[model samples]
Target: MDLSAINPVLLLASLLVAATPLLLAAIGETIVERAGVLNLGVEGMMITGAICGFAICVNTGSPVTGLVAAAIGGAALSLVFAFLTQVALANQVASGLALTLFGLGLSALLGQNYQGIKPPSFPRFDIPLLADIPVLGPILFRQDPVVYLALALTLATWAFLKFTRAGLILRAVGENHDAAHALGYKVIRIRTLAILFGGALAGMGGAYISLIRVPQWTEGMTAGIGWIALALVVFGAWKPLRVALGAFLFGGIEVVQLNLQAAGVAIPVEILAMSPYLITILVLVIMSADRSGAPASLGRSFHASH
Candidate 1:
C-alpha cells in the first residue's frame, strides 16, 4: 500500500463534496423530527429530486432551474406523505416507506429518457484572498455553492432552534402537540410545513448527487445516502451542528476508502469499498446509545382538536 500515493488535500476536498448531500438530507430530517414528525421517505424524496433536477438541467441548460425543479418535485411528492400522516392520520412510518418505494419507481420512469446524460455545470465561488491560501484554500473555498449553502443552513438551523420564537413554538408542538394545541398553536400545520421543508432539502440533496457528484443519471444512483442521512440524524441526536459534524466524519470515511482503493492497497476491494459505510454506521450507531435528547413526541400522530 502506497500511503504516499494519496493526496491529503484532495481527499479532504472530496470529503466535503461527498458529505454535502448527507448533511442536507440529515439536517432537513432533523427539523422534521424536531417538529415531532418522522418521515422515513427521505430516500424516495431524494431520488425523485435527482431525476427532476437532472431532467430540467439537461433541457433548460441551467443548473439553477434544475435545482428549483428538484426542490419542487420533492415537496410535491412529500405533500402526499403530509396529507396521509397529518390530515388522514395514516401511519407515518409506513407512509414514509411507501413514499420511498413510490419515489424509486417514479424516478426510474422519469429518468428513463435521462439515462447516460450529463448535467450542466454548477459554478463555484473562490473567496478572493481566502482561496489563495496554501493548503486550506482549495479544501475550503474551492467548493460547490451547495457546500457553502449547506454550512449556512446548519448555522441557520441551529440559531432558529435556539433563539427564535417560532423555533420555540415548533419545539413546543413537537414536545407535546396536545399542550401546544391547548396553547393555541397549530400542530398539524406546523408539522406539515416541517415535512415539506425536509422534503425540499432532501430533494436538493438528491439533485446534488446527480447534478454535481456523479453529474449523471443512473438507476439507484442515490444508493443508500438517504438512509445514511437518517442514521446521521439519530447519531447527532437531532441537533443541526452535531448532524453536520457527523456528516463530515462519515463523509471523510467515504473519501479515505476511495483513496485507499486508488492507492492499490492490499485489502480486498469489496472490504475497502464497504468499510466507509459499515464503520461509519457502526460507530455512529454505537455512539447513539443515549437517545436522551430526542424530541419527546417524535413519530407520534398529532390530531389537533380545536
Candidate 2:
C-alpha cells in the first residue's frame, strides 16, 4: 500500500470533479421532486446526453455545441415522460422506467459508430489570483467551469427554494397538488417545467462524463450515476444543501476507492470496484430512518382537470 502516492490536494480536486456530475443530476431531480413530479428516467436521459454530446462534439469539434446538444437530447427524452404522465395521465413510475429503457437502447444505437472515439476536451478555467494561493487555492480555484456552476447552482437552488414565491408555490404543489390546483396554481405546468429542467441538468451531467471526465464515448458510460443521484435526493430529504453533501460524500468515496486500487491494496478487485455502490446502499439504509419530509405528491400523477 503506497500511501505516499496519494496527495491530499489532488484528492480533493478529483473529488470535486467526481462530484460535479452527481451534483448536477441530484440538484435537477431535487427541482423535479420539489414540483411534485418523480421522473425516474434520469439514467436514460443522462446516457442519451452522453451519446448526443459525444456525437455532436465529434462532428463539430466544439465542446460547447456538444454540451448544448446533450441538454437538448435529455430534454427531448424527458418531454416524452412529461407527455406520458402529465398529458396522457400514465403512471409516472412506469413511464419513467420505460423512458430509461428507451434511452439506454437509443443511446447504444446512436453511439455504435462512435465507439473508442475521443471528444474534444473542455479547458479548465483557473482563477487568476485564487488559483495561486496555497492548498485551498488549487483545490477550489483551478477547477473547470462546470464545477463552479454546480456549486453556484446549489446555492441558487437553496435560495430559490427558501426565498422565492415560485419556490413557495412549488413546495406547496409538492406538498399537496390538489390544494395547489384549487388555489389557481398550475400544478401540471409547474411539474412539466421542472421535469424539463431536470432533464436538461441530467443531460449536462451526462455530457460532463463524456466530454470532461473520461473525454471519450462508450455504451452505458453513465454507469448508473443517475440512480445514485436519485438516492441522493432521498438522502438529502429534498434539500439542496443536504443533496450537495450527499453528492460530495459519494464523490469522495469514489475517489478514495480509485486511489486504494491505485495504491496496490490487497483488497479483492471486485470488492474495491463495488466500494461506492456499497457505501450508497449503506447510506441509504441509514438515511431511510426518516422519510416524513418527502413531498406528499411525490411520484403521484397530477392533472389539473380544469
**Candidate 1 residues 53-161, lDDT tens each?**
9999999999989998998999999999999999999999999999999999999999999988778899888878999999999999999788999899999999999
lDDT for every model? 0.91, 0.93
My TM-score estimates for the predictions, one after another, are 0.97, 0.98
- Candidate 1 achieves a global lDDT of 0.91
Candidate 2 lDDT, tens digit per residue, 1-306?
898999999999999999999999999999999888888999999999999999999999989899899999999999999999999999988998999999999999999999988787888899999999999998999999989988999999999999999999999999999999999998888889999999999999999999998888888999989999999999999999999999999999989989999999999878998988888899899989999979988988876663
In candidate 2, stretches whose alpha carbon ends up further than 4 angstroms from where it belongs are: none
| Count of clashes in candidate 1 | 0
Candidate 1 segments exceeding 4 Å error? none
Which residue pairs in candidate 2 collide? none
